[model samples]
Target chain A: MELAAERHGDMLLVRVAEPRIDAAIAIQFKEAMRELVADGAPRVVLDLAPVGFLDSSGLGAVVAVRKSIGPDRRLELAALTPAVARVFRLTRMDSIFTIHPATPGPEPTANRQAAPAAEASLPDGADEA
Target chain B: MKPEPVLAKRPAGAPRHPPDDPAAAGRAGAAGRGHGTTALQASRAPALQAPHCPDAGGRVPQTCSGTLRITLPATETGVRRGLAQVFAALRQGVLAGAVARDAAQGQAGAAEPVPQVPQSACDRIELVLAEALNNIVEHAFGPEPPAPATESRGVTAPGLIALDLSAGAAQLHCTIRDAGRPMPDGQAPAGRPQDIDAAADLPEGGFGWFLIRRLTLDLCYVREPGCNRLSFVIPLSAEDPPRPHGL
Candidate 1:
């Protein structure tokens, strides 16, 4: 699993370069994300446009990464391919994360501005235990 | 570690047919013909058999079902390879079905091309098969062996996974048999995906079976003797094309 991580202010944009995110690469994906966000970022956006297929194990790995980021930081998903998005929808994981239509780009302010109102409405520390 | 190959048989009462011999179609009785026409047969009878249509050169053009049967050790790489081969066979079967359908309508030599299984259906089958295969590779064979232990639980024991896929006009049927540990309570899990609270720790697992159940019809599982058999039917419909994005 190849992932390219770019830093935009306090947000990290990680793009999966693989067409598949199945059981074979699920663990590798989680480990890569953990390493990329080791220092922790205020927000992380996983760009899954290149991923044409995502199975349950891959979905779990994404969730595991989100939890590993802890409560202070948030993990969002962006640019999901139809097939990957379908998995998220079928599993109802879409409701749990802030999803963007496309990559928010280099400008962190643009992302904050484009963030959905529902995401903005989240209570402070709501994700914290 | 490679597990040994375990012989697998079709679930009790499932219609038995020769493996990939087009000539055997004539041997199948009328009842088998009905069973092979549509996935509806699976719903009506647990032992639904497949149709044994005549050869392509025969006078009557019928929807001839194709079957691919293979047994492999319960290893990750082996499962992956097996799935690839099975999917290829399924694609060929679908194409053959389309040709048979066209021939039945006297459109075999027409200028217009015969319709094939939609990309959506193929994608769904691939997804579902991946999940199923993964489950067998991970759980069925039991846990990995200790560092010094050369053989894993299933690797040393009678650990093998056999897959049989039958492709027809209305649906694709897959039968998976494994000589490994049975499901907890000897029954398939019926749990649905649980609601997640974002404020708490997000769930990292438990979605495999739910996806399988949602994507398939007439799903059934049986634990018989020393093996477990799981079979499911995936209906092919043009209306439900896979969306590339969003809900």
Candidate 2:
């Protein structure tokens, strides 16, 4: 549940520093998202570049976070790794969220489902949230 | 955190493998394993009786790929480790299956199909397994286990899961057994798809069985006298590229 949030202009970009968001930590992830979104950003983009696996519990947690943030606010997903992207696609959640290309990575993979990685260029500037 | 005891040692004759031994985990040569293969014949869990397997006495056709049997405590951490070990063994199967297929075709060509488990397939398997294992770990064994050996009718006691996973070139077969409570009506639930159209109050919990049903084939559930058994086969394809969207 190590989520680092950065304000990219009007949007908030939260990078999931964890490789997995499974049943083991789905609650923590939802709680962390709740706290991050407390800043009242209109749009929040979850950087899922590092998450290689996401189970049903993890998927539920993401949905729970969205509901907790209120319907007016948008919770977009960015740079879902191959595995995470597949989970979203299989569960049909991909259709629900507004997905965007990842920031950038040193060397990107050929998997067309996911965008490139982002941790390589994190501006660890103080947490605006 | 108290020291976990080696409470139930499986019978020496069981074909089970230690999850700690990664290299030895895959080669579960259960070809000649006699009648008891289907049942959890272990003396561990003294109160629980032996679970019955349908193919108990019948000769199991030889599975050329890796076969791994793991007896894991029904807990989140235990299921996580079990999934990891099974995933690793599956990778081994994929590699072996690919090489066997390649050599059988009489082509000593360069590495073709990425030589690893398909990314798309791995994701599905991981998600389905995570859902199933987490379901069993959390619900099947009831609430947090009562103090170790105290077994009452309320299901306050946690149980163990014996998992048999085999990865072949064509399909991956899994058989899971536990001493916990059986499915409510002696059958697995029909996990229906959630209506995402419900803008705000979408369901979160019931999606697991839907994913399991969506991803698996030949799914079957049975409640033996003292145990619950579930077996399913997930077909695989080496050359299946990722689908653009859900089917």
Candidate 3:
């Protein structure tokens, strides 16, 4: 899995570079987010646009990341794919954080379109884990 | 590492037709179908059972129900997919029922209204299932293929297998069994992302355990006697509860 982090004002956009956020990448996600937080980025926006799925472990990592930051530092999620979003919805985590839409809304980016096109370069089933 | 032979008990009772028909099928379509559709019917595990279990343990004795069994060579891939399919089917039904129950009770304001489960949930579950089954088939059964004739008959010894499903009131309890050299206690896989090292980068080698832990609400592994039983619970949606009365 690949991850890219860029600063946008006070917020940092961390795009999870993977097709699926099942078990194999859940730990890496926690470590990466911890490092990013330690690097002094304040507000964080997880761009889950690339992730097609998130299981319980993935959910735990996101929750852990949220817990890692101080109260002053805000963490938001963006562009949840349908499959991943279903997990959040099922577990009721969707209510905990500020989720942005595909396009930035009055709030941040939480729920996006019904379905987004797969990345042109990523092959189907490439992200098996 | 030679593959082992496995065996499964045939489904119970006389075969019945699919729910699509309560009555018997026309003679033409019924030709080779024995014990009918309800017994020994080929089913994709995830979509069907789960709503019937009343409690945990996945066992509903005294109820006249058909037993669904599977015996595959001890390959991780087959075991993972097979297990996932069974779980997905149960979870799907349970969740759907839950969503419906909430809707009927007009609990729209209650906790996200149990949003309609997207087809993506089903697909994701299927993928995860496949991964788990593969792990059992490949690793649990040792790094060897089963005998040809043994595979032809389906059961293979030293194979990883499981089948314990009982349902009650929006809950399906399942007990998955397998036969393999145990991998130490507390050595189950974790659901964290793997490090992207040279070897970890391989797409196929890892990820089975992660998915298994993620999708299951409760997972328990026990090694005793002759087999390994991995038991878990998949809560069903309460809208369309399994009609235990029918089974």
Q: lDDT of candidate 3?
A: 0.47
- Candidate 3 segments exceeding 4 Å error: A103-129, B1-121, B124-175, B179-247
Candidate 3 CAPRI grade: incorrect
User: Which 10-residue window of candidate 1 chain A scores lowest in summed lDDT?
Assistant: A120-129
Instruction: Rank the candidate models, highest DockQ first.
Output: 2, 1, 3
lDDT of each: 0.60, 0.60, 0.47
For B155-210, candidate 3 gives per-residue lDDT tens digits of: 22354454555443334455665556554663566545444233212222234465
Query: Model 1, stretches more than 4 Å misplaced?
Result: A106-129, B1-65, B91-95, B98-113, B145-157, B238-247
DockQ score for model 3:
0.04
Q: What DockQ, on C-alphas, does every prediction get?
A: 0.25, 0.29, 0.04
User: In model 1 chain B, where is the ten-residue run with the lowest total lDDT?
Assistant: B29-38
What's the lDDT for candidate 2?
0.60
Q: Encode model 3's per-residue lDDT on A31-67: one tens digit a residue.
A: 8889887767778888887565555556767877877
Expressed as tens digits, the lDDT of each residue in B114-175 for candidate 2 is 33344445556667777887788777876583233433332223466667665554566888
**Residue B11 lDDT in model 2?**
29
Chain B TM-score (each prediction, in order): 0.60, 0.62, 0.48
